[model samples]
Each structure stands twice: as structure tokens, then as C-alpha cells.
Target: MIHPQIPLILTALLFSAFFSGMEMAFMAASKLQLELQEKQNSLTGRIITHFSTRKARLTATLLIGNVFALVLFGIGMARSLYPILTAYLPASWQYPAVFIIIQTLVTAILALTVAEFIPRSLFMIRANTMLNVLAVPLLISYYILYPVVFLVVGAIRLVVVKLLKMEFSEEKPVFGLTDVDQFMKKSLYQHETEKVPEVDARIFHNALEFRTVKVRECMVPRTEIEAIEISEPINALRQAFVQTGHSKILVYQETIDNVVGYCHQLAMFQKPTDISSILTPIIAVPETMLASELFVKFVAEHRSIALVVDEFGGTSGLVTTEDLLEEIIGEINDEFDEESLLEQELQPGIYLFSARQEIDYLNDKYNLALPVGDYETLGGLILEMHGDIPNEGTIIQAPPFTITVLSMDENRINTVQLVRQAELTAED
Candidate 1:
């Protein structure tokens, strides 16, 4: 026959586990997910939303419930064990102090492992689901224990605010960047499992990371800029526009490094005789400037394009508002963008890429673990490795990768072929 103490001990342990698991589930569950559920107006959703707002009260209730359950467990355990221990132990060890020590040790071990660790871990794994499943029961317990919780929490707040001169505010943002980022990551993972498109998730991920991107990461390089000397005639500028098929052409002083401004194709209809007569001023920014900051500057200044400069104040590249936006939204291909900028996979481990492609972009798209340093583009990587401008047909060995220049002019690399030697050999 079961002892009367046995039923009390078992029930106490179950309540302890429930309270402990609910506490962890509340802390670990996503606030954004909770807010979304709250919009559904379900019973569980309403309870969770209410608890989310009064977090201190909820936390106090869980802790108080846990304490009561643990107290009951200790009482039941002591009563049940007393007779058994006294029956087995020698008389010298039957003292109250010794019995208390043994009882405390056994109770602590059982409570920590059975009531704390296991339940907390399992609940935290599917925190949102666990919260939704147990919301009603938690709410009932919350109200049942509210008076005690209110007194405990109110006393603590009073000490903290009144006696200690500490400020206290219970307000919390409904959601934060971290919440959105985690939500996006979870959605992406779900999309992968469901084999659904993840374009929206990818864009959200990019926007979150946009703050860290620098101007040099997105700008068209200096080598690719098309410009005419400021002293050049209007006809020469008009011819440049026709040849490059670009609506706007930059105007430089004596060299491209001394870029003055840009001239628009529509300015030609006004019959401007000189390049200076139609030059529209462009902003210049440092290469190290954050893309997000630059975007704010662009909007505030009512400008769309800016020239990026290095530390020495020389022109580094050109960045348009479209380019800045593309950092978050992906590529925006206008008519001016080169249609033939090569990017293709010829085979499993072989690829053809435009030399202008950013190293980070290549690494992310193709899983190329290429080393990143002071350089940005594929051509820059080749230059850093080879220590010189490579000619057409030139082969460069950057371990794990064999880069061969497919096409280049005297100044800049245009296209290249890359073979991942290790990947190919492994497959073979």
C-alpha cells in the first residue's frame, strides 16, 4: 500500500516542474511571436499578452508558486523519509541535525534534477508552443497567487525606487531589431524545410545588416567610371553619352581624380555649348562612411549620387542612391548597368565571374571561403595575391582556388575563371 506522504510528495514534485517549466518558457518565448498571436484574440493569446505586459507580476507569481510547491515537497519528503531512515540507521546517526542534513541533500538532488533542469530544458526548446499549450493553467495560477506576488513585487519596487533612489519603468517595446532578426532567421529555416521561396526573408536579413556595410562595398570602382575632361567640348561630351549609353556622364578637371561634376543627357536639348554650363554638382564621401549614414545624408541633401574618396582624398569610386538601396533590396539593374557582367558556373567546381564582383558577394553566393583583407573585389584579390596587374591568360594560385584571367585591359581585370582544386579533387 502507498504511504499517504507518497501522494503529497508526487503531487508537489509535479507542481514544482510545472511552475519551473512555465517560468523558463515565458522568458525564452519570442515577444514578436507573442504579439502576433495576441492579434488573433484567442483565450491563450490574451493571457500571454497580459502576462507579457506585466512581466514582473508574472515572474513573481511563478517564483512564488515554485517556492510553495518546493516547501510542500520538502515537508512530504521529510515525513516519508523519517521512518525509513530511522528504521535503517544506527542510533548515533538518528539525531535531528544529522537527519535534517541527509533530508536536505536528498531533497535538493531530486528537486534540482527532476523539477528544475529537465523541465526547463524541454520547455525552453519549444518555448512558444509550451506557453500556448499551458497559458490557461498559468493564468489561473497567476491570479490565484496575485495577492502574494503583488505584495512581494511592490515591496521590492518600493525599496528599489524609494529607498535606493533608482528609477523604475515597466514599459517595454512591443518588438525590437533582435526580435525581428530572430523571427526572420526562424522563418528562413522554416522556408528551407518547406521548400518555399525566401526572398522576403533574405531582404529583411539584408536590411538588418545594412548598417554595417561601407560605401566601398557597393560603389562602382574608379576603373569603371566613364568621364570626359572638363576642358572637353560639348560635342565630345555628347559623343561620350552616345558611346557609353548612359544618361549622365561625369566631368573631370585634368584627370579622373579631379572629378568636377556630371552632365546629364537632357542638358543637351538646352543647347549648352560647354561642359561647365551643364555640370550638376556631385557629393563626395569617404570610403569608410557607413551606407546607412550615407543614405540619410542623401535624403537630407536631396542628392542621388556621390563620389567615394580614400584617405588621401582621391576618388575611390561612385555610389548612386540605387546602389545604396541595392545593398538591402538586391541588385537594381537599370539600362546603364552592364548586361554582360559575367557570373556563371561551367561545372561543379569551376566558375566564370566578372572581376568587378565583390569578394563578399562571391563568397556568399558560391560558398567560396576566399580570404578577405584590405581588398574588396575579385580583381583586387588577384592583385593582392599576384602583387601585380595580371594580363589575359595569366594564372594565379590562391590555395584551394586557381584563378585565371580570361580578359583584362592594361589597367584593370575584366573577367576571370576560377576552379576550386580541392573540391574537384574530392569529387574525383
Candidate 2:
């Protein structure tokens, strides 16, 4: 018959292995694996997901159980080893320290190899199967020890959190806006490099970035806005409408700053041609308004276009529903819309781009290390470098890449060309 101490030691070893395996399995289980199992109506998946949702509590339960098992194992090892140590050592040297040291070394080796390492190794490779087999026992232990674990956890948290005033949250780490932007860009890169259908990839990529886009980034600048003065005659308004080929036009009283309203071409013909009679109340939104939010607001307000205003209540620009939608679906061209290339490689290394083109796009397409921070557009980047608006023919040297202002519109760079100085010199 086996000695009582031997049985106790063996039980302790099994207990240690069980808890270690459970902890490893729970932590290593992938979300995708859990999801697939849950879809297949697996009980283990449901249980694991439940524990995962309350990770802190599950962790506490595992720690408590593991500690209890190890304590029993330590006690049994000390008891069994005491006699063997006494037989080897002399009377003077046969002290508790000797037995304790030997027991500690042996116990640590046994705990690490037999209890922790082997179990953890097995659990990692066969996590789903191991977790499935051990689910009921783990769940039972979790519930049985929960009250004690909860009290211990609460007492520790009270001292660590309340008195220490440290932040402790149970929620899982979440992805921020920046993370989402990067993830979308990565996905887009994967699609492009992997040769996903161009149309599908473009649609997918545009849809992802649409939410983060701001109205000011895509709005038609005030300089380019076609507005009819309130005093303009009906015949003049009709002529202006025909020439502009715009269905609706902003109706301003004295200046664009005093934009009264907008009038539809259909309304203009139905009523008097005078801008005031056909004028409809227009909604004003800040330039900082997100494109997605603007889209929702447009639907709720039943309006097609809004005048983007500055902090000082002056008209900054105009944004249409089409402008917001185009952020996701690409440019919405119309009969009146001018067909122009936003970016073009003039030659081998030299390229010309519209000022409105985003700096990120230029960096990605040209494989240049353009620094990105507060500035979004190439014009903004140039302006930031100059500390003022750059004029026509302003050759701004940004090291590896040299930017030349090809065209300008008053306060901003309209068109700019970038060329690698080294590459251009080599060619010359």
C-alpha cells in the first residue's frame, strides 16, 4: 500500500498541473477560436468567453486555487524529506534550515517542470481540447472559490485603489481613432499589393476613411464658389445659372460673408427670377464638422448644401451632400465639373499635384518620407515650413525632396511640384 504522504504529494502535483493548464489555456485561447467554437454551440467556448469578459475575476480565482495547491504540496514535501535529511547530516548540522533549503530547491524544480512547464506547454498546443476537457472542473472551482476570491480581490483593490488612488479598470483595451485609421490603411495596402479588384479596394478603403474626414478638407473654397448677388436681375441670374450649369446657387445680399440663403434653379423659374423671392434658408456648419456627421445632419435637415463658416461667423467655404458622399465613393463628376488631374508625374522624378491633395497620399504614392503632423495637405505642409503662405515660384527645399510652387491663388499654393534633388542632379 502507498504511504499517506506519497498519496498527498501526488494529489498536490495533479492539483498544481490542473490549475496551471487551465490558466494557460484561458489566456492563450484566440478570439477567433472562441468565436468559431461558440458558433458551433460548444459549451466550453461559451464558458471561456464568459471568463474572458471578466478577466480580472477569472485571474484572481486561478491565482487563489494555484496558491492553495502549492501550499499543500510544500507541506507534504517537507514532511517526507525531513527524515531523509536527518539520516545524512550530523547532529550539529541537522537543523531545519538544511531541510528547508533542500526542500525549497526540490519543490521549486518540481513545481516549474512537472506542475507548470509541461502543463502550460500541452495547453498552448491543444488549448481548445484541453479547455473543453477541463471546462466543467474549472467552472466548478471558479464558482466554489468565487466568494473567497471576491472578498480577497475586494480587500486588495480597496487598499491598492481607494487609499493609493490608482486607476484600475476591468474593461479590455480598446482601439482608438488613430488605430482604426492605421488598420484601414494596412488593409488597403494589403488589398492593393495583393491585387484585390481595384474598384472594390478603392470603395472599401474610401468607406473606412470617410468617417475621419473633416468638411474643411474636402469643401469647395470660397474663392471658387459661384454665388448670385441679391440685386442681380432675373435675366442675369438665368444667364449666370446657364453658364455655371449649377442647379443651386448661394444668394448673398452684399458680400459672401452676408450669405442670405441658397436658391434652386427650378425655384428660380417657378417664382420671380429675383434672388430674394427664390431664396431658401441655408444651414451653416463649422469647418471642423466631420463628413459622416454632416451626412446624417443633411438627411435629418433635408438640405443638399451647407455654407461652412469660420469661428468669426464669416463664410469660409461651402460643402454639399455630394462632397461628403464623394469622400466614400470617390469624386462625383458632373457636366459642369472641370476634369483635371489632381496629381501627375511631369517626368521621371518630378511630379505636380494640386495643393488640396493630402500629404499622406503623396508620401504613400511617391514612397517619400514626408513628415506628417498637424498639417494635412501639401499646401498646409508648405505653409507650415514657410511660417506664412508661399507665393508662386517659391522653391521650398525640404531636403531629399525639393518643392517648387508651380501656381498660387492669393493666400495659398494652388499647384506645387516635387522633385528629388539628388535624382534630378544625377539625371542632369
TM-scores of the candidates are 0.88, 0.69
lDDT against true structure, model 1:
0.89
Candidate that scores best on lDDT:
1
RMSD of each: 2.9, 6.0
Top model number, TM-score: 1
Clashing pairs in 2: none
lDDT (10s digit) by residue, model 1, range 1-428 = 99999998998999999999999988788877788778867788778888878767877888999999999999999998899899998998899999999999999999999999999999999998899999989988988998899899999899989999997655556568998798778776683446433248878988999989999888888888888999988899999988999888888998888989998899999999899999999889999999999999999999888999999999998988899999998889964468766899999899999998889889989999989998888999999999988889999999889999999887789899999998899889
List the candidate 1 regions with Cα displacement exceeding 4 Å: 39-46, 86-92, 189-191, 194-199, 266-271, 344-350, 364-367, 423-428
How far does residue 291 in candidate 2 sit from its true spot (Å)? 5.5
lDDT of 2: 0.80
Worst 10 residues of 1 by lDDT: 191-200
Please provide, for model 2 over 37-150, each residue's C-alpha lDDT reduced to its tens digit, 9 standing for 90 to 100: 666788987777677666677888888889988999999988888887888778988777877888899989998999999999999888767887887888999999989888
